[model samples]
Target: MDRYLNHHLKISGVSQQLFADAAVTAIQQGSGGLLRRANHLARGALIAAAHEKNQIVSAEHVRIASTELI
Candidate 1:
């Protein structure tokens, strides 16, 4: 969880709490919850892939994962 938070903060330049709160808002309203969950899962996969590749997580990776999931 810390890794995910740190990755998001570093890559997106947003605070962990702020990102999390926005995710919760998405869960409650926008995207009907499933998209929110899919996004979270995609983020996790991106982080894992970045870690494995020894690279900084990028928005491109997240975008591709989201597209593939959809």
Candidate 2:
């Protein structure tokens, strides 16, 4: 999961990690271990973080994205 996150974020221009550990766990659980779902949630979390002007994505941001998507 960590490697997956790292590769995607790196290509997305995130030199440093954007997600907190708790957020990563939340995303994993929410994604149900599916790469496509994980990608969706991660993208949503990034948008949520950007909207809030947050430097890092938190579990709250993931929750917010989950709610908005579902």
Residue pairs whose backbone atoms clash in candidate 2: none
Best by TM-score: 2
Q: Pick the candidate with the highest lDDT.
A: 2
RMSD of each: 8.4, 1.0
Tens-digit lDDT track for model 2 on 4-52?
9999978878799888999999999999999988988988998999999
- Residue pairs clashing, model 1: none
TM-score of each: 0.33, 0.92
Compose the digit string of candidate 1's lDDT tens values, residues 1-70.
3344556557887653423433333323423446455456546545655666834444444444444554
After superposition, candidate 2 runs with Cα above 4 Å error: none
Give per-residue lDDT, candidate 2, residue 32. 95
The per-model lDDT (C-alpha) reads 0.47, 0.90
- Prediction 1 TM-score vs. true: 0.33
